[model samples]
Target: MLKKVAIGVDIGGTLTKLGIVDREGNLYAHMDFSTTMHKGFGDYLDELKNQIEGLRSQIDFEHEVMGIGVGAPNANYYRGTIEHAANLLWKGIVPFTDELKTRYDLPIYITNDANAAAIGEMIYGNAADMKDFMVITLGTGLGSGIVSNGQLIYGYDSQAGELGHVKIVDNGRLTGLGIRGGLEAYVSSTGIKRTVFYLLSDMMDDSVLRDYSYNELHGEIITKAAEDGDPIAKAAFEMTGKILGEQLANFTAFSHPEAFFLLGGLAKAGKWIFDPTRKHLEENLLPFYKGKVKLLPSGMMKKNAAVLGAAALVWNHLQE
Candidate 1:
């Protein structure tokens, strides 16, 4: 057993989550911070270094720091940088991993956040026993990490599994990726909001939602309303599921993974997402895969999935 620990960084458009994880997949210390704004690469890196070094001030443990693993939006495993991230306010490619590695003098590995989440599932979550699987992150955008034969399928240039960009509703809605009618256009946070707004106005009596501005409204609000038996909220979830399920059917045919692990904000909607997702997935799947594949929740603790997954990148490299 290693006495030291590796740091896992889960970078998102909204927040950055990180933790110190041991070889045994145990998380020790954790931090939540904002992603470096359009604040150039160096500025972003310095901010992260300061936050990480600050952790030493709080913990009184006797262990060495091993390395670092990062998960970010559009992170290219081949380039070790984040490319054209819309939410991060980045205009072009930024070499986050390389810059951080030079500053910290530590081995660093980086990949897209969704891929990290999938690896976390493989090494520490529900897919630990499976060789082929998919991990989907349903937040502001839909992200996916593909695992086949117990290894991440980064493909050439480390840009292999981009499940979100897969077109589901052609010409349906524009997405962050410059594609119209992609899966995220249907199932992402904004999609859910649109669904709710439409339902509140056109489908059901949504007095609860009609009161809030779309800017102030969020997926959580819809979930809460559903919990309170709001039919409009329920309709929104069902419609979201119908879209995701249709997309999954196509994804399943191509990958044939044993299971798909879901994480992120919209995923937390629970049955509001699951029930409809499951219903649509089964309805769309071919007869051959009808009863074969499974849709399991993250086996890794809910909030801990991203951190553990980022760490898994390090642990996975070590094991290799």
Candidate 2:
């Protein structure tokens, strides 16, 4: 069968990724553009329209657009809207899906980045056969996508899964869920750094990290140190993984997902994180579920995952 080429757009706080894809999740041409703040909260759709059109001319879609799919921060799939997204510089609700439809004259699928990532996994990654699973993204902040019944679970108003904000520690962990401790507080690189700063401060012994400002200390630096077998860095990653793993056990009671796909900056910490995560998850999981849930790395390539997800959403929408 001739595959229908679909366009996928992934909009983040600072950047946007776009691509042309097919039902099989094969992406042909991909590009990126900046997301500049629009003046007076006006239409940034014009820019997107122009850019997509410009790309279409170069790529030459054989079957025309099957559909257009998008993944954005605070996106509502059910409503086809972008709400007040933090760090996205938009004051009011933006009818992004509707705006794109008018320009492209085709079906448009819009979802939050987390949901899109999950969809991407369904079509392009390891979860193709699993109806229930979760994709956890660890970066500047944390994000998640839930899959149930071989479909993306777009909850009421499309805010179904915001696992990062789920409170883990009693009282204020740091502002996630208005409480202090949460999954994000550990798994997120930002959270790891905070813990690192506190750990380092208490050490009373100077280390290489002492030279760098906390703001300047990034996930990569810590990761490199861990690779070199630095005890502090390694300990930080272990603690992070332990926290993440423990929470997965808690969420499993509700979702019964087969596997949890971990992605993004902190996830790459590898065994330093995964080992502890596995151990902790095993410790807390229900006896029957203990050996069931697997902590797997995201099969989707980091750069391609979001765009592929956005495109896969359109493909999924068409099939539905």
Candidate 3:
């Protein structure tokens, strides 16, 4: 029997990843490239086609490429377009599926990256048995995917589950979308870096983080400093977690999910972020919600999770 696989594509502001995944969740021929290096979306698509053809040449076994699944910022599953994605260079609504159709005559699907992560969890990760859960992607920005009663809530406009953009404070940090006080502005990788700088100004503590400039600072640097017991770095995690945990509690009051899986670079901080977030979540939860919801790392953390999640869209759609 010829093996069947789906081509998964995850497009980010900085990078684009591609992988071939089988029904059994086995991944093969995965690769990534700089998305920003391309001059335009059309150029990017040409390179993507070339990359796909190159990937297929690497496989020695017999296989059938079933479809293409794409996870992109601001992707609309209903419309098959990426509309006004603040992170991408593309300005207007780009007919993503239509573009792909011109290249390959295969079933194609698209959704926001976070939503893809949630579906990937259901089909290939830890949430296979759970009915209610949330997947929080904490990278360049925060992205959320909310699943209630075993269904991914796309809302009326296919724009629901934007928990990251929910306002947390008035006159707070500004986001890429020019929105002030959005949760992601203060809880994402960039958010924690801002927190570090904020603490640098308010609290006069002698620390190693003071040595690095704003451009030099990143999640890994802060995580390393925290691990080394730097007060400023540790304090940043504490503050970021506290805010995120409080928001999670608020989300709980509404949807009441069984768990919230944290993914991406900031989540790699492990105890520094998780401990405080868990503490605040418990402290802020309503009486009935306390100790009921679990905060866990993503099961797909070690793998090309985003890629798998994108591929899962193909398997998921076929099932329906």
Candidate 4:
């Protein structure tokens, strides 16, 4: 019998990554396409089809393609649509899975990128043996996936885990959702940049970050500066961690997750961000829950985490 494989697609703001993956979480082959080139959804679909066909040709005769799984921003697992994802050029509700089904007769699964990361953790990462945990993706925006009793919590509408949108501060940073005080506004990579600017204004500390304009500033620069012992950069990470830790504590009260696996670019800050977040989270948690929930970096951080995450959706579906 040939080993079964699944196609995993991860659609992001700038690029779309797809690959062939097997049961052991190995991505056999993968490729990318510029998402910005296709303004229309139809054109995007055509390009995706072409690329997938190209990937299919690489598979050996002994392997069988079993299913397809997609991880995209604002994707709905229940509806199989991308609903008003602000970052994408295509607007409104996109019948994503329906469009793919038209081209291929196979099992298709779609979910928000964060939820996909959670499933990835369960299938390919550290949470495989754990019954409860949360996966938080901190990129341009923050996204979360909560797992309970070995199941991803989709809630009623397949959109339960929007932990990033939860309010943390009164009149905090404004988010793309046009909301104030969102956790993403404080904890994401963008949030770190914002914090750097905010600190530059309030504190008279002479630092390297003060040299860069707002448009030029990024999370990497801040992390580098912090590693170099810049006061402003260190302060920025501390503030971001403080806000993130408080919110994680709040989330703990509701889900009581055994751990939180932080993924995406911001997690690369290592102890600069984690130390403060862990300290604050433990301090804020209720006495009984304190010290019980662990905050850890993602095990798949160095791997093609998003691609593996998308593939994990198919693997998870097979079990169900």
Best by TM-score: 4
Worst 10 residues of 3 by lDDT: 20-29
- Candidate 2 local lDDT, 1-320, one digit each (tens): 45478889989877877888877777788888778645533456777777777777776545677888899988888888989887687767988777767777888878888888888888878898899999998887788999888877777677988888887777645754466766677668788898788778766654566667987999889888878777677778777877888889999998899999988788777777788888999899999997899999887845588888899887777667
What are the per-residue Cα lDDT tens digits for candidate 3 across 152-184?
A: 889998999998899999998888789999999
* Cα-based RMSD of candidate 2: 1.9
| Candidate 3 Cα deviation (angstroms), residue 255 | 1.5
Q: How well does each candidate superpose onto the true structure, as a TM-score?
A: 0.91, 0.94, 0.95, 0.96
Q: List pairs with backbone clashes in candidate 3.
A: none
lDDT of each: 0.82, 0.81, 0.91, 0.90
Estimate the TM-score for candidate 4. Answer: 0.96
Residue-wise lDDT of candidate 4 within 261-315, one digit each (tens)? 9999899999999999999999999999976999999878998988889999999
**Between prediction 1 and prediction 4, which has the larger TM-score?**
4
Error of 1 at 245 (Å): 1.4
Q: What TM-score does prediction 1 earn? A: 0.91
* Regions more than 4 Å wrong, model 3: 34-43
